[model samples]
Target: MTDTLKIALAQLNPTMGDIAGNLALLRKARAEAAARGADLVIASEMVITGYPTEDLVLKPMFLEAAESALQALALDTADGGPGMIVGGPWRQDPTARPPLYGKVYNTAYVLDGGKVTTHRTKHDLPNYGVFDEKRVFGAGPLPGPVNFRDVRLGVMVCEDMWKPDVSECLEESGAEILIVINGSPYELDKTEERIQLAVQRVNETSLPVIYVNQVGGQDELVFDGASFILNEDNGLACQLPAFEEALEVTEWYRGPAGWTCNPAHREAPAGGMEPIYGALMLGLRDYVNKNRFPGVIIGLSGGIDSALTAAVAVDALGPQRVHTVMMPSPYTSQESLDDAAEAAQLMGIGIDSVSIEPAMQAFNTMLQPILNGAAAETNAGDTTEENIQARSRGLTLMAISNKLGYMVLSTGNKSEVSVGYATLYGDMVGGFNVLKDLYKMMVFDLARWRNQVLPKGALGPAGRAIPERIITKPPSAELKPDQKDEDSLPPYAVLDDILKCLIEGEESVDAIVARGHDRELVNRVWRMLELAEYKRRQACPGVKITRRAFGKDRRYPITNAFRGPA
Candidate 1:
């Protein structure tokens, strides 16, 4: 009997729908595990087709392709080397009529000694907040344990481990150890939650648990891989680094008392802005590279938002790989231009200057007929003219993006996007918005943090990359004469707090008003948020850094008439 076993947890990043590429990665991971003397290797859930494959699983050809890839991988695991557990989509038999036999299951298969031995599917399917697993997969029944040499192992996929009944079932089936494969996306404090859950399960079942997770940025979601192992005694044995790919090997020995985990190796904690910063960088790099963009282009308005975005782009891709453009209109201040130029210089990136005077004039000339005589004056409404300037600038940036092969990075903060302060199809025209989920207050904090502690191996400007004037200045769109953001919206400090309550806390208008906020202010903000749903739906994808983002994480109907009482 195998008294001592080496298990490898492959925490890797897999691209969606890239079956061949994903298979290659799996093979490479398997080789690494084998080299490290691992007796068994485990990967994250849905490793073949990637997590949250959504509608791709509905296609028969896609399932066949995934199955073929899995078979090829199983063949590669021949020669009685290390056993492998891989995740993919599996279809049940088509004959049984009552329970819908042809249902799809999010499954994991264990391949050992040149053959497929056991399979298990996810039982609990999550359907809230960026997940539609129930729409795709059928709930799987409780699976039995798999015997490997002397030890009995139970496998759980993703959501299975979240519930206590599954672990209890595994314990009842006489399993000595439980292994969970997850494709859990990163949320702030999610790692702590995972550790607590693992400890709880270990204490309840009196069996050691190994949790393996996927790592990478898929569209708006970022997965932080922090695989861990807990002993039957409810003690943490080992933990891998977050936001990275690692092949962690743990040794288990059968003692006189029972099976116990050996003193496992651990990596140093990569905290203090490392995880969030790396997530942002990876999201940016993959979004640009995966979309086949040659590089990225950003409009560097002389504001903290654009400055940070520019820095992020330069860090994600090299400075040479980024292009900056400063499109200043008539209302744009000379100080802003100077700061923008200084930022470009500091970052060692070139910038092009395009004045929007010509385009603004053309727009005004064209709109004169529709506007009639009274509204066509030079001194029109401040917001109307300011929005026109912003639209003109957006058009110019988009043209440059089209002329040159580059993806545009929008620089709007969450505060602006939340309040409908941004112009639709104007400043919002971009392939990706870097800080769309970041509040204005958090934006300032992040800028300060970046300046203080430069990220690992960052190549951008070192000390205070953002100009002091940009950070200190009152934020303005510079669309009309002396137009400041405060003129329209509340101060960022007050605005962000209210937004946090309304969006993240889901506070009603009455609740917000009850929190010492003015009744009129709460109602106005709520109205703005409700009206902005349509614009947000049309907005581009952005990295999600907040608990609730405007993208897939928060889905509100655009055509709803359920306004609160006035």
Candidate 2:
């Protein structure tokens, strides 16, 4: 065996369903590694098909196209560049018995000298939390090590590294180094967990490890590609940055003990709102770009939720790609109007004024009987009028979305979404929501954070995208005169904490109340949260920054009846 070996870790962004574009990215990384004299260029899992292909794996034509792309990549290795390791769906053995026939496995191809030298399928098909691998692809066999020129390398796919048995079997089967390819998505503290998991494996097998992950947004998911290398002693050797594509060659030297990776610069992972902001940007960017939406249209109210959503939209897609509309009612405060205009100017996004008063009057004329007979109201009218105005705004936004190709961006925060504080066809109408999982308190925090610094990939001006007045002002729906959010809900500070414990921490009402909260309020918030399950179930998909988001991470049935303690 050679004393020295070089492996290129390609942490990259992949567009879902673009087989050709994905292959081009892989080839480009391959050329870069070849230029650096690396022996093998390793890419993330399902690099050719993007990730979480969902039900697309069930299509026959897509699988054929993906296989064709893989073949093309293998043939390209004929030019004598560094060999390629690419991930995609490969059909199971045709000679196998009935049920297994025509099945596809989440397979990785090892290509060199114009041929696929070897292929290994992923053993642990992850089925939980944003993964539905078991539904689409069949499980692969326990993988053994592959013989490279000098090293017997144990190759594992994304979920394979998460479990212990796979790595144990690989070590016992004569694998030298553990090289894992991943399409791991980003969560609050996942990067740290990944490192510790890798460390655990290294301690068990007495072998070095290299982890390469895919970066970029895929629908509701964002993959933070902070790949790393760890020595046999569980020491971190090399680290890559998160939320972006990176290609780095790691030098390994085999000795009497084992392979020790040469130390490289370890970038501190992004902290505080930086990582959260990055996840939002990448998630929105990929969702817009990959889905081929012309741009995004946001109903820019003077409220914090709308302001932050607009800011994220501008950061994700340039100002030119984000269009804003201000649908104002009679109750729309002058302060809100001025704040919305100021935000538009600061962010350099165009804003149009669309009055919802006419539609509101029309709705009132139609619903007069119900309002007169069955509603209690002040001089301004009742909740029926409020809902009409909201629904009118929703109609105007949807019309704009249909006229132009811009997707509507919803601005409801998790606090409001959790308690059903939003109108169904009104403020909740949007193709996607950038902050569906963020609590109201977190929204203010991120907005403040954005104003303080020009985050990377921000398309707006350097100053504040969220105006000071907007941030400082009391939040309201402005449906009725002098209406405030606090009229219906508790302060965001109290509400968000209760939500974090109940939704994320899954704590009981008594447990949350033990932290000095009103038992009555805790029970009330829990009821609202439980009752709003249907709304959340129908809400547009959003980026997840917290540990347990409202989407896949936290799945409560709309028909759920269980409630916390009184």
Candidate 3:
């Protein structure tokens, strides 16, 4: 039995469905770890086929491809380099008949001595909110510890470590060290929760736990690679940085007491708005780059939503790849125009000024005679005209996007989206929405936070990507003369609080009223939130930052009639 061990945690980013590319990345990480004198390398869950493959795991050809890649990786250990523990989908019974053809488990393979020595499957399959693993993958049996080079290594998948059963089984079966490979996605303040859970397991087993998580964007989910290690004493031994790919080699030695880790690199956990901003930046970057978009185009309306979107785009794709345009109507103020121009210059991106007055006038003239006929007189209102202006700008952005091959980035936030305040095809038209899950108040808070400090690995300017005036000014859509968002909706501070209760809290109308909101206003906000489900259903995908993001986290019926307590 060995008394000393060297294992490397490989925190990496894997693109979904790119088997060859992911294998190359893993090979590179293994080489780097081998050079550091690591005896074994542990990668995040599903590094070969990417995490949450969804229905792709159901495909026979895809599974075969993944198995092939895993075999090829197993062969790489023949050079007497570091062995690897990699996660992938494995057919539980490959020789089973037709009905069991696609039955696969989320399995981790232990590769050494030119072959896969043994494998462990995940016992728990997550089913709620952004996870539907139960539908795609079968639950694995509770596993015993994996014997690696005479050391008893307790191996668990992502959710397996969340509870005590798997760890208990491993410990009872003679596990000396606990190693968990994960594809855990990022949510606000979730890092602390993960650490707390690890501590709980450590307290239970008195065994050091090493957690490895992937980093990158997959659809709306963004994984932060805050992989870490906790000693038997429940103290942090190592921590990889969040939102960045890194590899750390940890040395473990068995003492008279038990296994102990030599304290290694521990990056200070990201706090405050740092992780939030990193999530947004990395989410946008991976989405654009992975989907092969040349760049992003934003409709910079001199509003907080659009301004923040532009800043994020600049930081994500660099100034050369980001483009902005100002589509002004007759009611567009000179201050707004100047602000848009200044913000564009500050971010060092090109801005084009395009007036939508022509489209507005044409639509009005075309509809005037029909309305003058008296049949449509009752239906005509200022809202129709305002929406026309919004649609005209949307059309302008789409036209530019078509010509330049750049994706149009929508700028509406959760507050506007939740209340049906945003025009559907107008402000909501985009291939992606960076602020889709963020509220208006969060938009303001992030804008202020971003200006004060340059985020790590930011491609934008050092300070003040947004002008101070833009933040302090009252938010307006500029669709009508002297228009402000408050004209139709409640104050953002109050509205966002109510929304948090309704969307994230899922509190009933009366429960929300108990939180010091007007009863009638609470009911009204709930009504608006329910009515806007259709729009949200059709909205583009954005980063998932909150515990209850709109898309996969909160799934409400669009055509429902369930009015809670009056």
Candidate 4:
């Protein structure tokens, strides 16, 4: 048995379903670790097939490809370099059943000496809030420690470390160190929660821990690496940066007491709006580039939502790639026009103006006769007219998107989405909505934060990317004359609080009212939230920032009749 050891935590980003590409990433990390004099390298969960995998693991061919790539990497260990602990799907029995082949597991393999020495599967499969592992993977049995180079190492997958049972079992089984591989995604203040959980495990097991996590955007989910190490005495030994790929080698020595890591790099994970903005930028960047879009074309309305969307787009893709168009109608104010142009100028992006008044007139003329027969007279203030303006802009934006092959980026916030304040095909027309999960209040907060502080890795220019006027001005859709959002919905402060209670807190009307809101208003907000389910169902995917984001995170029935107590 060796008295000294060196371990490397490889925090990396992998593309989903790109088995060969992911294998290359692992190989590179291993080589770097080996160069740094690491005995073993630990990567995050499912690094071989990217994270989540979703139903892609259901296909036998995909599993076969993943296994082949994993074996190829295992062969690389023949060079007597650092061994690897890599995550992927493992097929237990390939010829057992006709439908599923056999039980499939989320497994971690230990590759050394040109072969896989041992493997462990995930014990707990998460089923809540953006996780559907229970449907795709089989639960692993309670596991013991894996002996690597005469040292007992207790290994746990992503969700396995959430509770204490796995750690307890490992401690009782004589595991000296706890090593966890994770694909944990980012939510608000999630970094602290992870650190606390690790501390809990350390306190319970009385053994040091090495947490390795992946970093990248996978559809709606954005994984923040922020991998860390905790000493046996519950002291933080090392911390990696959040939202970035890193490889750090840690030295360990076994004395009379047990294994203890020498002091290494420690960086406080980003706090407050920094991580939120990073998640947005990274999420948007990956979605567009990974899907192979030329760029993005946004309908810049000069409102807070649209302005923020444009800034994020430019920061994510750079000004050269992001295209902005001002789709102005008769209701579009000159102030809005100026604001949009100034904001675009600050970001060094090109903006073009297209008048939608002609299309609006054509649509009104086409529908005037039918509306007159049904409602006595067609009123300009009617929702039909308002909808036509929105549709006209949507059509114009879609036309531009088709010709230029750039995806449309929508800017509607969650408050607007929850209350059905968004037009279906109008402002809601986009391949991706960056602010879909953020409330209107959060939209304002992020915009103000961006103007004050430029995020790291932002491709846009420094200084205020969004004009101060845009941040301070009253928000409007500019669909009708002198219209404010409050004319149709409650003030954002009240609306966001109530919506958060209903959506994230899952509180009833009575419970929300207890928090100083009017019971009737709470009931009305709840009713609107329920009624807008169909619209959200059709909305494009966005970055998930909240614990209970829309889409896969929250599932509500469209045709339900159940009502909460008022």
Candidate 5:
């Protein structure tokens, strides 16, 4: 038995489809590990193609490129440096396969002495909560441990570590310590949940576990990368930072009591809007930067949502790259205009005004025959006019996007979008939305949070990016005279709580009302949410910060008529 085993966890940021870049990162990490004399270096899940490759893994070229890169990495390790357990896509023969098989797995290759020794596939392909692994990866059988430098190191790629059976099987197969590689995305309290999960496995197996995760944003998903080591007793030995890239070697001792990692740095896990804010920053940054958008343009309404969206965009793309446009209508109050300008000054981004009244007037003139037809006779204060104004703003933003080469940033928060409060192709029009998963209440909280702290890794300067008045004022669409959001929907606190119950908990209205809400209100909220699924279906893709975001996470049928409570 080995007296000591040193393992280096490579908590890295890998760009999607950047095989050469990912390999270079792996080689550098390997070099760092070798310098530290680590026995084996471990990287996160799919470090070659980046995690959650989504539909890209379906392309044979992408799979082949990743495999080739993995081979290149293996050849480089021939220099007799530290052995590595690097994660990547591994293509299997598809002659005998099911429909869901990419035949390529979310796999990890254990390379030692210039050859790929053990290529382990991922078990437990998670289908829910921002993951569609089962669609892309064929399920791996229960993995056994790989004997590396006299240590039986069991590998669990991402989803494998989430459940018990994988670890149980590994333990039964004589695995001493577990090394878990993850592309786990950031959600509220997921860091602590990971620790607890690792603890559960350790308790079940009586072996220390090393949990390593990828750090960065991949489209909507943000991997926090709070990798750590847990002792056999489930005590935290070493912990890497969350939402950032890092690498550290942890020493382990294998005595009669099994393996125990040496005590190392313990990062105090960040909670509340800070982590959520960081997720938004990273998700937005990666989407804009990786896709090579010159900049982003946001229609700043001077409301909490748009203000917060602008703040996050500036923080993500920096002030120079974030452009704010105030497309005011006839009903747009002077207060909103002033606040928007103030917000732009604070965020250090340029703000321009394009009055939509001209467009609205032109639309009204053009649509007068249709809008003033028999349909107008029945309705007073019709929303058709409101939507026209909104669509005009949308048109202007799209034009700016086309002419100026700026990707439009949608500013709708989850609360408004959840109930279809946003106009179709109007406020919902954008290339991306960083605030899509954040509820209305969360927008207020994060705006306040952004003002207080210069969020770590944020490029924008601090100091009240969101005007305080914007947060304190009642949120409104200002499509008509005195248009407050509460007129169309319930209070945000009640609304957000109910949404949490329905969207995340999948709770019935009866269950929701049982939690002290009025039954009628729950039913109404449930109705709005159900009715809005169609709108959500057409909404732009956005960063997913919550456990159950609208797009990929929640898949409610639009044609369904299932109502809850009353």
Candidate 6:
């Protein structure tokens, strides 16, 4: 038996639908590992087809392409002599009986010396929030262990490592080490949770675990690649960096006690708000770059929301790629205009001032004929006026987008998105919404945090990227005179708390109301959220920082009659 085995963890950022590109990356990693005399190279879950391909995996041609890619990968690794554990979609008999032969599996294939030997299917298929694996992939019945270089290794996919049953089965089958390939997405403190789980698994089975995770932004989801290896004694052996792609090579030597990993070189920790900030930056950068968008343009109102959005845009793409348009309406404040110009100048981004008064007047004048008999003093006219202003701004932004080939970014926060305070076709009109899932309170906190911990090459103002008045003053849509967000809705502190309970905690209305909230307010908020489902459904894609973001993660019916406590 070999006393030591060298293992390579390939933490790669894969682009979805790029089968050939993904395969090339896999082969490159394999070649590098082989050059280093490593025994095996382990990749992340679904590395070939990319993670969360969603319904794309169900397509026959897609599956065929994936299968072909897998064959090519196997052939590439044939002469390398180093084994590889790669994750991809596999076909089952589509026309089988009760057990269903055609059911596809979220599987990992073990290839060595040009031959595919072992295959393991994921056991615990997570169906909750952002995971629909149960609906797509079939569970595997076998819990067999694979033996390579006299080492009995247990391999499991992402969720399989989270469960005890699968780990126990592998341990019982005489597995020496547990290698888990994951496609885990990033949330606030998900890295800590993953560490705890890995430690718990090691304590349970007395086996060291090596976790390799995919890293990249996929639409709303961002996978932070902070892969690690933990010893059976529940000690941290090695940890890779977060929010970046890295190839980690570590050696495991057999000792009198058992296999002990050589002390892993740890990268600098992205502590506190760094990971979150890095996640947003990477998510935004990838979303723009991957989609082939030339540049991004945001409507800057000098408010904290737009100010923060502008800062993030400039950080994600350089100042040259970020353009700001200040669309002042009748209710626009002079202070707001000054702040907008200041922020644009500080960031060195292009700024254009376009007054909406002309467009707003034209819209009202055109509608005057149809509304000749309508009451001018009614609140309906006020509402129409506000909507027309919003729509006019949307039209102007869309025109700039069409002319300059820039993608408009919607600047609505979760507080407004949650309670339907945002105009669907107005402020919500954009190719992407950066702060859709960030609460208003969080927006303020993040702005402060950004000011304190500015990015390395930030061009924006050094301190307080957002104006102090904007953060201190009550939020307003600036649609009408004396319009404050508090006048139409609850305070952000209370609103965000209630929303966290309802949206993230999934607490019922009565449950939320029982938490010292007014029943009427809870009911109103719930109704607004329900009614705004259609709008959210049609809203632009944004990064999902929260656990229960209103994207693919939180799928709800638009026409549902379901209501919370009356």
Indicate which candidate wins on lDDT: 3
Sorting all predicted structures by lDDT, with the top scorer first, yields 3, 4, 2, 5, 6, 1
* Predicted structure 5: lDDT: 0.86
Off by over 4 Å in 6: 93-102, 268-271, 373-380, 456-464, 508-510
Expressed as tens digits, the lDDT of each residue in 81-125 for candidate 4 is 999999999989865343552278999899999999999999989
Q: What lDDT is reached at residue 94 by model 1?
A: 33
The pairs that clash in candidate 2 are: none
Q: Which ten residues in a row have the lowest lDDT in candidate 6?
A: 93-102
List candidate 3 segments past 4 Å from native: 95-102, 369-380
List residue ranges in candidate 2 displaced over 4 A: 94-102, 369-379, 564-566
For residues 1-566, write the lDDT of model 2, one tens digit per residue.
57888889999898989999999999899988989998889998999998988778777778878989998999988997778787888886533433432287888888888888999999999877667788878889999998877688899998899889889999999998999999999988899999989998998899999999999998788999999999998888889999888899888888889778999757888788999999999999888888899999999998999999999999888999999999999899999999999999989999999998878776766666765633322225667678888889999999999999899999999899999999998899998899987889889999999999888766767877889999998999999989999999999999999989988888987788899999999999999999998888888998877777887777888887787432
For model 5, how big is the CA root-mean-square deviation?
2.3
Deviation in Å, model 5, residue 366 alpha carbon? 0.5
Off by over 4 Å in 1: 94-102, 268-272, 374-382, 457-461
Each prediction's TM-score versus the true structure:
0.95, 0.95, 0.97, 0.98, 0.95, 0.93
Model 4 off-target regions past 4 Å?
Answer: 96-98, 373-379
lDDT of 3: 0.91
Better of 1 and 3 by TM-score: 3
Instruction: Give candidates' CA RMSD values in order.
Output: 2.3, 2.2, 1.9, 1.6, 2.3, 2.8
Please state the error at residue 536 of candidate 5 in Å: 0.4
Per-residue lDDT of 304 in model 2 = 91
Better of 3 and 6 by lDDT: 3
